[model samples]
Target chain A: MEDQLTLGGRNFSSRLLTGTGKFASHTLIGPMLAASGSQIITVALRRVDPKAPPQDNILSHIPDTVTLLPNTSGARTAREAVRIAHIAREAGCGDFVKIEVITDMQYLLPDNHETLKATEILAKEGCIVLPYVMPDITISHQLYDAGAAAVMPLGSPIGSNLGLEMKPMIQRIIETSRLPVIVDAGTALWSNHQPVCPPLYLRLLFQPLHLLRVQCGYRLSQNPADHE
Target chain B: MNININGEAVETSTPDILSLVRARNLDPSSLVVEHNHTIIQQAAWADTLLQQGDTIELLSFVGGG
Candidate 1:
């Protein structure tokens, strides 16, 4: 929790980021957000029903306390992702865009070339681009050079529940990256396998932090201000 | 028509800066100015001008971030 995660000029106090989707109810999201201690909340842009009937805005349920990260979840190409980013901005999400270039349906791996291209163009257009990419150190460096504020590598394919299979690559990326390394997708929990933590160059997505705190058997104070 | 340039009166023998700039073959990027306290963009600066005491300020691009 003490790790510093800086993106787009704003320094976030917590590394844990939660998604606004998959919650049972909108009411449950609030408590989950509080418990997760996430400063950023990722929202799948494709899920937002902009053309919904007056009484049924799915996005209306999301509380304002969490900063929304509109992700291009369903986009298979850079062009589609860029178009979705424009749509998100028009919907008042502004230039804060998460570039998700998952082309493969089975593995959900990011297309490094398309992701790099999208990142360069989006960043030049003043969009704060956070790209979800593969755990390749070279690709991560290329994305960083392309002006991505953060690079999110998947631990495994989305929803497979496989945790940190690319530990060696993740370790190398964390060591050399100038941008934040956000481990996204997969798994229910981080492995309690290592005591000598790899010197993290700013990790994001708080599930790991929470697990660490719990592992230490330290009870965090309930005061919101103290933690926030 | 009469035009003002930095509080000084001048008459451009044309309607606007665009026509004048075009006629003179001037590059719009070489100059910077402000219209009524708001900075006129480089692309639009050549078309902007003072209309009878309309406030105008001239600015030059400097090398720095």
Candidate 2:
């Protein structure tokens, strides 16, 4: 069991990297993070809460144990993705960057062309680029050659909870790539496993948490100490 | 000659790696060189060949936040 994964010289203890987009409130996010036992927390660089006044800083509540993983979510092109990475790096994110060039809003699929080009460029620029690409073996090889620190291949569309749709390719990627391979996006198996929240906002939610439970359960049961 | 960085004009001369970087007047620590869109490793920068019309983008990783 790999307890901590090192990317670009930074050590992270948690394998579970949780996204902060869907959580109802900042108050809940902290507890959920604790519940999830995730050390790596993903945050979108483009979307900042604007309704709150400027004086109120939203980033205060996030615990220090959480290793901030700033993602390039909204960018459509390689240039735009690089620009976002630059801003995040400048904003004290250290050298880590999650490259996600999502061109389709509905599918939330990464634009393969843009992703490869950007990863190559950023790797040259000295930023540790972890790209979220579709399950393409050729792209994976190109990414490794391009100097990516890691490859995050989507299981399904973003937020779809479709666990490892491209199973064979993902397994192949995991086997072949020298870098850490994280199965990112569409791993929403939390609805059933974690029990339904009593809140009205979540009442209509039909998310099946069982998928997430199995994934976490297998990981935790195999090596409980790894979770620590 | 397009531009002279240190003292030597940018030319097609296949100079030694140290001489090439030295002629460019670039600090190896501050800047990263990407020639022809491929990132030149810090260790290999001196040995990397500089051709005429080679598109180089210099990137600086500095402190922020």
Candidate 3:
């Protein structure tokens, strides 16, 4: 029984997905990818700066073996998100698109309604749509009905490093969803000795729990009190 | 003719998308060209002529979350 994560008719051995952002230098990306063993990584698209000095192409740093998950991070509406998805695919980023429609600048929470709208359109267009959204069971069902490949519920706000603040909602989503429930953001738990663990350690700590849940048929105790 | 590239108006005599990209010293292989809201593949860049007031968006992959 080989464990693999399937998305859009493609199989990936690694369950951990990493982002290519917030790094001090682009040179570290290749090494990071090699060390983390992440099969899929997220990237963003933006208008090329005309005045800036020529820089190395980001794609060159990424290995061909890894899958690129281009996100619609700057989109504020479904229409904008759909446009970005088309652009990303046409740009040779593949069919995998992470719909991230966010208008709330303060909290950076995803707009669930707009995310669902984009997911419905992109999935129909034959894209492997993975929508990032707040943890909500109703929207999770809606995303499934809209042909989403998986649902990515945030553990907390994006980049907050608060760890599973929305644990209860995420657990509910996991319990009910037929699609894969990927906990997307706010994963860096606080540490006493260090501010946060290295990215590799974070992945190592997180992946086993995910595997355990999946291996056990997701049969965690249903009762909220049972968790205590 | 004057055309918009990435929301900035530029005056250029470059005839096609390929020439325009070269004139700006941009790497064609690393770019995704959107001409008037529709994507233009690299193979089609030479044939895609630029016109006055045409909106061209030049985009590329960047590190982001």
Candidate 4:
């Protein structure tokens, strides 16, 4: 038997999804994707800066083999998120859209209500919606009912580097949800010291915990051993 | 004509979307143009003309999580 993660009628061999953010240089992205073996990568859409110097397009760095998962990061409302999703699809970024509706700026906690609303609308629009929400079992079920392809619950606040702060709640969600549960943010394995385990090791460790998948947003180091 | 591009008002004599992009020295293949809140496909850029007070947005993929 082979292990595969399926989303939106497509099968992916690697369960780890990577993001194209916080990188020191765009040159590191290609090698990082190659090393991580991530089949799906997340990107954000923004207005082109007119004053900025001409540079290589971010899409040019990403190989055609990988799937583009464009996120609605800047949206604060369901309507805004829906608009971004439509634009992303029309821009030829495929059907995958990650619904991230954050209104709380201080802690950057996701507004579950707006996220659910966006999920409902985008899913109905034939998008493969993956909503990032707070770790709530009821909300997970609601997302599934809303036709979401997957439910991404945060382990903690975004980019807090606090690994699995809401582990118990996330565990409950993973246990009950029929949809794929992806641990999206605040699961970084660094804290002023060298990481105890590599990313591959962490993936194997997560098996007993029943974590379906994980998305990492760490910068890729030159040395394979120097895992962030 | 004056138009709103990415929330900034700009003055230009460029007629079509393609010409406007060229005038700004932007790569057409690397852009997604939104005219008056509707995404205009690259293939239609040559046909989609700009109008005064029209809102245009030039979007591209960026590094984000």
Candidate 5:
């Protein structure tokens, strides 16, 4: 497994990047990370109570082998995202940040306009900015120009788990963009062991999540690591 | 004196950020401080004294995505 996915000047053999949310507990994250073999894990920043003791903190659970990618999930605008990035780095979380700006409460879609603004600001400040945007080629190019590390296009709305619904647009972006196209959201599975997302589960599941994401019509990109 | 820390009112007599960190049993190296909307660097924590009616926000990365 010499094949590696490089981001922010670092190489990751395990292309999979898993999330800390939607899990049973912080303890489960370790085994799930082991099962998935993800080199990178994403977490969100929240305001903690001053009186509460930091016993089961997420940082204490994550293994030191994996890199921490703190996402700006609560941000509604670019300015707020930038602020969070600074706070994350200052908190010793390092420079890796996932810029997620969502204003649409109904669909929970990523706002590309504000995302681009935040990317430009944070990337300039030496943060590896990975933005989650709608599957649009033009906006992907803009984000690349804004110094983004990778263009993370959503397969569907956040938490929808309707994997790669925007197949045509995501394929177009993957094919045309010079930067790496990361399929970020819309990956969902059921607790009952039922296959809620059919296309992805059927077509691609044996490999890592970052590799072999669904493009138009269950097609696998020629090179799983390089392409979307 | 009373000060706001992470939105909770705390009555502490800690003279500076170092003392405050010690008082709260917080690892001085593990947390970042935003005192009144400005990020106070770790090096300045000792000199950055706490004051009455001052607002201090301590933020740390947690486990959620």
Candidate 6:
């Protein structure tokens, strides 16, 4: 077994980190979390509808033991990212934040310059920052100095589901990184030949949760775990 | 007076930030406030007095990845 992965002074037995983005139902989150055994899950902060009723959202579905990693997904610049980070922390999501600064709307690639700037600022302000980048080694080194708890490099474009197109670059980053290299996207283990489809792949890949020792979502029409 | 909230200009006679939240039917405990781009703690909502042209941002956590 891969030993426990440590980040932000906390030891996580399940290296697999999951995201709650494309689930068909928010109510399914708890059961999905139970099945995957992910220690850390990501959530996005947003403006509450003042006119609407306060319906229970994703926060209510996730287990209390799982760490809530609020991501700055919509931030397009370092300043905006810094602003969101402050809001997330002040809202009691704690100091753990995922810095995702993406300006290119086409590919949705993470802007390395803006992310680096945000990481420097948030880290100094006592946040356990995890930056999602386009897989660059020099930037990873810089983020480590900025007190980043770990560096999350994309396996492919965000939500592309292309599956590790950047594997070579990601390997270089993992090899050179001073901090833990948690592959955020495109880490799913599936090929077209398998009887298990993408949804099943999404669910079961994380079920071998501890295999990565420091790692590991998207959408699907059906709940993937139904196959088992 | 007109105060900008979440980028929409609105006229309100609310005395303090807490009242604005209450007037909007928001649960103060469930909302996170940013006044003029600076975070205002929930405990300080009563202490945070609003003024004309103040920018108030109300945020809450949602499902994301």
Please name the candidate that would achieve the greatest lDDT relative to the true structure.
4
Candidate 3 C-alpha lDDT tens digits along A1-228? 887878789998777676777555566666666765667888899999988877668888889999998999999999999999999998889999999999999999999999999999999999999999999999999999999999998877876767678877877887888788777777656566333433433345443334111100001112111111
Every candidate's chain B TM-score? 0.51, 0.58, 0.94, 0.94, 0.89, 0.94
Cα deviation at B45, candidate 3, in Å, is 2.2
Per-residue lDDT of model 1, residues A1-228, tens digit only = 476666888777776665654443445445555765666766554321223322223345446766667787778889878866766665555567889888788887778788888888899898999888787889888988888988887766665545557657766777777778776655334346322221131234332332111111101122221222
Best by DockQ: 4
> Per-residue lDDT of A50-122 in model 6, one digit per residue for the tens?
6776756567787889998989988999999998988888777877999999999998899999999999999
Q: Best by TM-score, which number?
A: 4
Off by over 4 Å in 5: A50-55, A189-228, B7-14, B17-31, B38-47
Q: Where is model 4 chain A poorest over a 10-residue stretch in terms of lDDT?
A: A208-217
Regions more than 4 Å wrong, model 6: A49-54, A186-228, B27-29
When summed lDDT is taken over every stretch of 10 residues in candidate 1 chain A, the lowest stretch is A211-220
lDDT of 4 by residue, A101-172 (tens): 999999899999999999998888899999999999999999999999999988778877677788788778
lDDT of 4 at B1: 98
lDDT of 5 at B31: 70
Report the CAPRI category for model 6: medium
Which 10-residue window in model 2 chain A sums to the lowest lDDT?
A206-215
For each candidate in turn, the TM-score is 0.61, 0.61, 0.87, 0.92, 0.79, 0.84
lDDT of 1 by residue, B1-65 (tens): 56555556656665555665455443444333445655556567556753654554442211100
Question: How do the residues B33-61 of candidate 4 rate in per-residue lDDT, one tens digit apiece?
Answer: 99999999888999998899999999988
Worst 10 residues of 5 chain A by lDDT: A215-224
Model 3 lDDT tens row, B1-65:
99988888899999999998998899876788999999999999999999999999999888776
Query: Whole-model Cα lDDT per candidate?
Result: 0.58, 0.60, 0.79, 0.82, 0.74, 0.76
Residue B34 accuracy (lDDT) in model 6? 91
In candidate 6, position A14 carries an lDDT of 74
Q: What is the two-chain DockQ of model 3?
A: 0.57
